[model samples]
Target: MLSNDWAIEARGLVKRFDGFTAVDGVDLSVPQGAIYGILGPNGAGKTTTLRMLQGIIDPDSGVRRILGADRPHDVAHRIGYLPEERGLYPTMKTYEAIAFMGALRGLPLAEGRRRGKAMMEEHGLSYAIDRQIRQLSKGMAQQVQILGTLVHNPDLVIFDEPFSGLDALNQGKLEKMIRALAAGGTTVIFSTHVIAHAERLCDEVAIIAGGRVPFAGPVDVARDRIPAQVRLETRHADGPWRAALPPDARHEGALWSFPLPDTGVEPLLRALIEGEAGILSLSIERAGLHDAFVAIAGEAAARALGQPTQEEAA
Candidate 1:
């Protein structure tokens, strides 16, 4: 049984390559049995941070703990890691490749092979057990690698860009697999720049930009950073209510849009009614993760990273 409340923790993490600082004072607190996401664009130091947490590379400063162990190597057997790059032997049979990964993590060859076969059967890949990896499709090959990562049944799993090369259907499958892992009491952490995946899959997320975290916490909290918006359309475009509208209000044809005030929309509604404006339509638009990302990371940064500012997928 795990005694620690947090599955992974890091503080003041700093990684410097020569004079260039890749990661600067980044901190994280991931809860047990939860799906957490480390989000950032390419070259934003996400991989460097993950490397430090997994003990593949030591941080220049700060401390890290994984599965209640201060030394990552001490709990290596309890953690399963899938790096961004796929390195399975092309000539190895699918089952052999999975069993080999488990063996490296301390499972005996016979037990590893047994678990590998069971895992493949459970995931609907039993038919490919004897086929060489090179003969499988890209998606199938990636799935095999993921199964290998879990062949030892580790308590915590870390994936770097798990959805990178997957098609929409395969990405959906990976998302369901991640949720299933968490439901079965595994702490799952994955890094991705795609806000949509994090929005759909993570219980909590940390937004990393330029080697710094501007926001970290529950997904709802990040979304709450930006106020809701109110869009209104009236028959009288030149009505007195137009004067009552906020300065930021924008007009496009008959529609006027602006951020809903923190005080609420009651005042605006009353003002519109009093001005005798013909209310054609009025609706509130809640901010989503994409909007929150833009609000926290800046529109320019979001654009430069090729992330959509609106709810639309990038």
Candidate 2:
């Protein structure tokens, strides 16, 4: 049984297509009023797991509870789901489309339209409310669909690759909207292959690799799996302080970069000063979600996914 404090709970979820397994014994727990993310590469079974949670597809074996209900339909009206594939009636007016989606989720047509108009006004899309979906720009169309998903004011919202196909400006807007949703006590779960998005927006995250989840926890905890690093630059490269440098230190130009030793930076600073090394600069770089994902999911899997590394993103 799932606790009332949890918005979503899944146990031992397994899904197979023919002889190939898409998800293998996955478990997930999303707390109420939290923004959770599922991070994975393409074909990493992220969509499969989300589909099972929404009851769009059944797991071959497992139990899932949404809003404390064992059956999805029992709480269908409370969930707002934006699928990976965007589906909107191209000929329908933006406001009409939003109201129609809300109607499907059990909202009355009149109430749906009223809420849809309000949402458009709030999102600065009131000017485009009567425009046909096909007439809107890609970003506008995407935003319209998202507003539709929220028209009924669902308590739990799930977005699959919401950042995909969006420009940087639109991506920033979506991120703000997601944060606002969580702040308003909605449990927001999103799946993204982009580590940076997950790092910036998620309170907790689950990393999926090759149909299995190897790490699931707070974003800071994930980042802690990798060590912190320090980059030092000095005029004297071959001084007595060299002995104090870590074995993995690498020289690039005048800078020496290496992981910060567990013993701490104070000892290294003392050694450098004692050796009279002219310290030009010393900076510590903390490991981020991208580093954690690469460390936990393995470099090979990360490479195969072709997602940008943290350094590259930076």
Candidate 3:
């Protein structure tokens, strides 16, 4: 049975295509009003899993519940989805496009139009209000589609690669919009190959790789899996305190870098000062989600993430 506190829940979900496993057994739990991120590299079955969750495609096996409904159809009108592929009616005016999108979700055309124009004004897109979608820039067009997705003010919103193809400025705009949504008590779920975005916005996340989830919990928990690192720069390379440093400690000139000492940094700091090593700088850094992903998902997945996307390559 699904819990009332959860907006989404899935268990042992599996999906296969043409004898190839696209998504292996997967599990997820999303709180009622959180910004949850599905983090993974390309070809990691993110889209497939999302499709199954949306009831766009049935899983080969397993079960899921969306907004307390076993059948997503019962609450389809209450959810908004922005697919990886973007499209809109090019001939329609910007506000009309947004209104049309809302209409599809049960808003009246007149009410949708009124709300759409108000939204455009609020977002500084009022100048494009009367302009046709085809006349807008690619980024502007995408913004229209994004506005359309939220025009109905759905309780749950799913965005697949929402940041993909957006320039840095526009990407920031989208991030602000997502934050506003969460502040308004909406549940926002998004998938991205970039871990940084998830680290910044998500309250909780599920790290997926090779179609399976290896870790799912608070962002801090994911990062805390690896010990904090220490960067030490000292005048003297050799000292009695050197014994406190790990064998794998990296040295370049006067700077040294390694994981924090098992006995803790205080003992080492005390020894370094007493042993007469002139400390120039010392800083400890906890592992970030990017580092956690590499540690949890492995280097092969990291390579896939580092590869430039088509937009970047262009």
Q: lDDT of all the models against the reference?
A: 0.89, 0.90, 0.90
| Model 2, CA-based lDDT | 0.90
Query: TM-scores across all candidates?
Result: 0.93, 0.95, 0.95
- Once superposed on the true structure, which residue ranges of model 1 sit more than 4 Å away at CA? 1-3, 309-314
How many clashes (backbone N, Cα, C below 3 Å) per candidate? 0, 0, 0
Candidate 1 lDDT, 1-314, residue by residue in tens: 32367999988899999899999999899999999998888888889999999899999999999999989999999999999888899999998899999888888989888888888898899899899999999889999999999999999999999998889988998999999999999999999988899999999999988888888899999999988889999988687877778899888998988999777989889989999889999999988888888889887668766877664542
* Each model's Cα RMSD: 2.7, 1.9, 3.3
The most accurate candidate by lDDT is: 2
- 1 or 3: which has the higher TM-score? 3
lDDT (tens digit, per residue) of candidate 3 on 112-174: 999999999999998889999999998889888999999999999999999988899999999
Error of 1 at 7 (Å): 0.8
| lDDT by residue for model 2 (1-314), tens | 55666899988899999989999999889999999999988999999999999899999998989998999888999999999999999999998999999998999989888888899999888999889999998889999999999999999999999998889988999999999999999999999988888888999999998889998889999998988989999988687888889888988978888999898999999999998778999998999888888889987667766866555654
